[model samples]
Target: MPRSRGTNGTDMNTELGIVVAGVSTIYGRAVVRWAAAEAHARHAELRLVTAQPAAAVPDRYLPNDVATAHRAAAVRLLADLAGEMATGWPGVIVTTDLATGPPAAVLRAAAEEADLLVVGADDASPFTEAISGSVPGDLLTTSPCPLAVVPRREWTASTALPASAPVVVALDESTISHAALAYGYAAAARTGRPLTVVRCVTAGSFDQAAATAQARLLIAFGELYPDVAVSTEVEPGDPRHVLVAASRRAALLVLGSRGRGRLASSLFGSVSRDLIRRSGCPVVIARTQPAPVALCS
Candidate 1:
């Protein structure tokens, strides 16, 4: 077996495994729809993990039976969804699991043996503030594997474009961005779409983005994905704004997070959070874990 270097400069091996977070949320269902297809395409198992809160204790009384009841209901919902997916996509093995704690931590724990973790992201609003809040955002830092966040737009094809739309990715000089670039190439290859490399510069256009070392690194990955049509964009504006505008017509948008922390408090940086909420399509948050080395594969 060929070995590839990791962000920490260690060689590693990878297998096909994916974990998807599912709950009673629109984004959650979207996650299932998108990840199930990806699982089948990669010949991987789709494990759906749902989090249920345990009943609270008053330091003396019986455990809240209400919490236990809610947990059971959540489990039943997940099992039903898993059964439906297994029936719809026989090529993809499907399994359901329940965990305790917040959605972010639960999914992260389940993603330990997974190659990729999938979740749903909603546009942050006061109405959804307490509902979905930052579960998807929190996973950015806690996930041990790459994470894909699907919104309603992409899953429902509300953007009025085919999968042939370009696979857009945010780029920078960081290793995490390179990982995102590598993922962008793989996604483009899988969807047969062109790859657009973008860098949002604070001054004088994105001219410097194409001239950076990371740009060269992207070209290196191009050698492995020879047939992926690739282009570069350097826009002069706030990155949070530029990337969102660009994602409108993109078949899929990919980005890298700068955090390695497992804490929910720091899961999303400004850029990742903005895109996750406002982007026009599905977004994949690529990290340096599970090895981004084969990106130049």
Candidate 2:
């Protein structure tokens, strides 16, 4: 991952952060639709924000007049998006913010209050090959909340998914990995989708002890999401490749941070970034999960 010019952190905030440029930026609508679906499902607020350098930016890009015009256009774009969501997704409360500064920095500040920060890929093959800076590119490493970058190809309002389109989640030995599983299961349950638990296994990767641990995690999810149809796969191969391919038929892919061994800091790991670029569906990097609440009788 390239170095980010912004602060890095894990755990998506309670709000939804949608990163938008003045124009559609190509895949912006896909992100908004996805975020709207998420907000509706989680019963959370949607925060649509457009971060810009400045209307009076000191040369290099657009002139002051042109830049100011661009900012105004972007603000209008947010209003249009908010209006569409308000009508299209009734239960999801939508709001907009237009801030002046570095887009990435504004994104980080916005992420601070977002449970999931959604962005669209400027370059379609960004993950497979290499490309320039993207809204979620450098920022991926330090996103305070889980980040979802819908691919240009997958950015659409089509809810037409086959029943087989499951919510596939990658599992690891990390304690935080369970958070990814829980998130995946909940997403599946909410949307009445199936859930698939996958762990990439090498030849001798699953020793008896490891197998038992994996079963434990699967069983835990089953207990929680008893009504959701579930399947398990100990696929043989690289985890990133396996998940990326599987995502072609998936509705979403959820993953956990590859923790800094013992250092106790979180950064978006290699697998998460690779999949975000390559996955056919939306990819979510599970930063942190909110604590379970008890029902008051």
Candidate 3:
């Protein structure tokens, strides 16, 4: 049995909300499995959200039949996923909701009270890469909680329970990055993995201010994960480039979905989106979503 408990030993009443978008894609099953497993592990509630065009029928400008068809499709997709999940994990509470808006905004609102938000990595539209306009990319930018980007393949137990793996987290001395750090530490503690914090600075001469910032971030990690082994690195290069390079040897790469400066772009910010597309390991984007009351243990 899974029990939900906060780090501070409180019960969490809210569910671990998963925003499932692009149900028409091949990655749908994988996203469902991953979300179900995570919810089971955390003993959190799971909700499936879908967004469709909301023009009313009959008296409206658009045909209601079109909306009905869309709703039916969403329902079928959820049913298929529910059937698949039930085989492996029964009694898992799953709910479905349909909203009318862009996929990102609809899921974000549905996940308003959720502990974690999950989205598929596929961009259903053609202009995905040029604009980073995919739903997952958009959610990373504006989600109210932590976001998990699931690839189009199920995560095997072997992958989740690797021996002596490293949890790599990128830190930049910002509040968002600190949240990433906190998530990394918690993950490292729960998984019994060593924690490594990497700070990437632009390729240039190292200055005292940069070095001090790096040291402070490392110290914070040390304080957070005192029982676990923690390592720090300060490298000079494009943040994404360095982080992805480091991710090759890591089991998981944790990053902040957004940063403090206006310099960060809209599309998953530059570093996070790049790593998500390129990293060989799983990537967890720590954003400002609702915190779960209890995490299943």
- Candidate maximizing lDDT: 1
Cα lDDT tens digits for candidate 2, 1-297: 111111112233433333322224455676787777777777766777766565464645756777667777888888788888777878556767777667666666777756777776554322212122443344565667666766766454327788778998876433336567767888899888899887766554455664565577667667778999998886787776788888888888887653222111122254555566678988776665443442100
Model 2 misplaced regions, further than 4 Å: 1-24, 54-64, 123-138, 173-176, 203-211, 258-268, 289-297
**TM of each candidate vs. truth:** 0.77, 0.76, 0.72
Judge candidate 2 at residue 161 and give its lDDT. Answer: 82
| Candidate 1 stretches greater than 4 Å from native | 1-15, 25-27, 58-68, 123-137, 152-154, 157-161, 173-176, 204-210, 262-268, 289-297
Task: Give the whole-model CA lDDT for all candidates, comma-separated.
Answer: 0.65, 0.63, 0.59
lDDT of 1 at 79: 69
Scored by lDDT, model 2 comes in at 0.63
- Model 1: per-residue lDDT, tens digit, 1-297? 122332223224445455555555345556686777777766777777776544466323655675556667877778677777777777566667776666566667777777778766662322123224634345666667787767755484323567558999876432336567767888788767899988666643333443555756776787889999889886767777888898887978888754466311121254676677788887887765344454433
Candidate ranking under TM-score, highest first, comes to: 1, 2, 3
**Residue 35 CA displacement from its true place in model 3, Å:** 2.1
Model 2 quality (TM-score): 0.76
Off by over 4 Å in 3: 1-24, 55-69, 90-92, 123-131, 134-138, 157-161, 173-176, 205-224, 257-268, 288-297
Clashes of each: 1, 8, 8
Instruction: Please tell me which predicted candidate would have the highest TM-score against the true structure.
Output: 1
